[model samples]
Target: MERFFKLKEKGTDVRTEVMAGLTTFMTMAYILAVNPAILGTTGMDSGAVFTATAVASAIASFCMALFANLPFVLSAGMGLNAYFAYTVVAGMGYSWELALTAVFAEGIIFILLSLTNVREAIFNAIPATLKYGVSVGIGLFICFIGLQNAHIAVDSSTLVTIFSFNNSIKNGTFQSEGITVVLALLGILITGYLVIRGVKGNMLIGIFATWLLGIICQIAGLYVPDPDHGFYSLIPSGILSAPASLAPTFLKFDFASAFAHPLDFFSILFAFLFVDVFDTLGTLIGCASKADMLDEDGKLPEIKGALLADSIGTVVGSCLGTSTITTFVESSAGITEGGRSGLTAVVSGIFFLLALFFSPIFLAIPSFATAPALVIVGFLMIQQVVKVQWDDLLEAIPAYVAIFAMPFLYSISEGISLGIISYVILHVAAGKSKEVTPLMYVLAVLFILKYIAL
Candidate 1:
């Protein structure tokens, strides 16, 4: 036993481990809604897309547990969805099927890069701030998503009019907008309390409590969705199976339209490769930095395995009608729950697989029930804006650009574009021109071209 893996030698027992797994599961439950919503909107069968999303999550989680030996969970990523849906399809006028084809190609490219460790060279070559620029930019991008989903920012009508939905129905009567605002605000407060106060499975508890209260007040009604159509009630098979979609497609890979738009093709290629590698690496690095889990040599043995799993998951997902699968930051919430090893991931993965049996029930939970939790999460992301280097214009410009542009631009890629362009300009103007590399200059030019053309 003494010679076993670090997990056993770390003095954790089975009971303690199980609790850790449960906490990890609850903390990252936010992904259940986030990933599905993004992929489903891509015009895939909502049920089938959700099924692939969950299966990809479970497979990636299992790979992390068995191969990576770390506690991090993997799922369809936040920023990656915007790249797939908003950028590739909507922005560039590509069809969803073509986008899926492109996603598969990118995954294969990622696998090759990871295998040859080309990503490592780029990782080492880039200046730390550029990485910071990319990450901080991505944070803004993710925050924008949270806000848009919560409707904190709505498109204006008749020359950009802004208004709240003020009509919250109650017991066959209308409540004052002030009262609803206060209630939504109160819901935010309570959910924030549970998370900050360290309640066990805080997100789950917050969601359940809010929804239960809503039903009691008739603010929400419980209804079973089509059993065969939602996340939990069924895991559809046949044409919908992950292997069926991916394997055949990969074998018959398409490139007829690949070079149709060279810049767009290259930009799409660059965005996926750049965002996926750096973002995933950043997540792994951030969690490692937090958990004291880095090796004495300051390395994660699981890095290579996790990379493989993530790349495979991405290809599989596109084939199965979904978006890119990347390592999730939600795993950090699991860290707060005392999950120290892959065992936690294994249990959480099992839980997700079993989750398919109860999609109708889970889907029945009203959006408002989760609204409070989402609002709190938005605040969490918003707070990152303050951490920007306000005292120094050099850092502050890019920081503010990333933080504000995300919500304003309504696209993570655009927000990141603004951040990168600003970072490059500020760095050059600061007379520390050497700090900005040739590669960064290239990215900056690309960012500029894409946004202006858009």
Candidate 2:
């Protein structure tokens, strides 16, 4: 195992890798329930989605370990799945199958881009300042997701809101009334404390601790359990079960219908492709940086392999009945756990496969448990902000735009698009037009056309 994974060379051992893998899995296992919940609203079978989520995540992470030999895990992304179900299917009136077809098309495009130098060129063209910004932005984005998932930060109709502690004390929402916001707070505190004290596998310990507390609260009637509701209720039931049939959503893409309208078809395809591309780029850079895997030039080695793993995963996921498959930002938690070799990804893949049969056991872990890991990861990632040159407006403003736009707009693609466009304009206005590459101009125009299409 050491020879295969180069464990000594990477300065990590099997035990550390295994711990990192478990840490990564615990932080992201919420997707098992969350993906099915979101996609189920679009007519896909919940059982099928559950199976697809596990299978796709396993396959993608397996490829990342075997092919790319990197400590990255891939799964169906949170934001794009929402775009697929809500924006494409519900809002645009397209069929779910048609949306899958678009994902498949995007995967094909990604593969081609990876095969050529196009993908690498784009990754290299992204300035270091913007790269640092992307890292910090993704950190904030992950924290926002953690808070929202835990229901600690509630969103009003127009703006995002937070749970009221005063209200919790004085006849405000609790247990049956609220989504266990106090539990989430406790989780954050416990996990943050462990992380600050440099505890090994702090994230996993925090999650399990929080989950145990949740169960205690449920039994004590301080937290009500709702097994029949669509939401995840932290209710524990059976430990293991047979894997669900994937027949409902497997290979269900309707390419014929998706291609019926050329303009809209290509537009949707571009949306998926662009979003997947930049999302992968941002995540790869961010996680690799955390692992100290980047070279002196701030470039990821074997990046094409990593990108191809993602592209291939997306295609396989489309065939198996899910949305786009991409490297997760949550993998930062694993990197933080001393994972530097592909063995980390391999262990994570194994955990995902195991989830296929023992899903209920894994799913029983409440969002409040996992949310703390994400919050701590956000803190870890945002430290890159110190590397940015804050004195230069030409660089600072664009970097800040990239950093803040992600959480504000709720889309990594949109944030990157805005950042790239701003970067080009700022450099050009400052008589440094020569600094902007040809790829930047192309991306700026494409992003403009993309928004115009909407």
**Most TM-score-accurate candidate:** 2
lDDT of each residue in 300-385, candidate 2, tens digit only: 87798899899999999999889999999999999888898889998998999999878878988888778888988888989989
Runs with alpha carbons beyond 4 Å of true place in candidate 1: 1-44, 78-96, 121-148, 157-172, 175-184, 218-305, 335-340, 374-396, 410-417, 436-442, 449-454
Per-residue error at 421 for model 1, in Å? 3.7
**Model 2 shows how many backbone clashes?**
0
Q: Rate the local accuracy (lDDT) of all candidates.
A: 0.60, 0.86
The TM-score between candidate 2 and the true structure equals 0.95
Q: Write the per-residue lDDT of candidate 1 for residues 1-454, one digit (tens) a residue.
A: 1233366665565555556565555545556655666655666555666666777788878877766677778878877887777877777777666677767888999888778866554444334333344444444444344344334444576532323545444565444332333344556677788878977656556656755554454434222223343312111222222222233223233456676766667777767876677667756654554455656544555577777778888887776667788887656545545567777677777766655665544445544445555445444434434444567778677756765664555444455557668888888988877877676677788767755754
Off by over 4 Å in 2: 166-173, 177-179, 227-235
Predicted structure with the largest lDDT when compared to the true one: 2
Native-to-model Cα distance after best TM-score fit, residue 161 in candidate 2, in Å: 2.4
TM per candidate comes to 0.70, 0.95
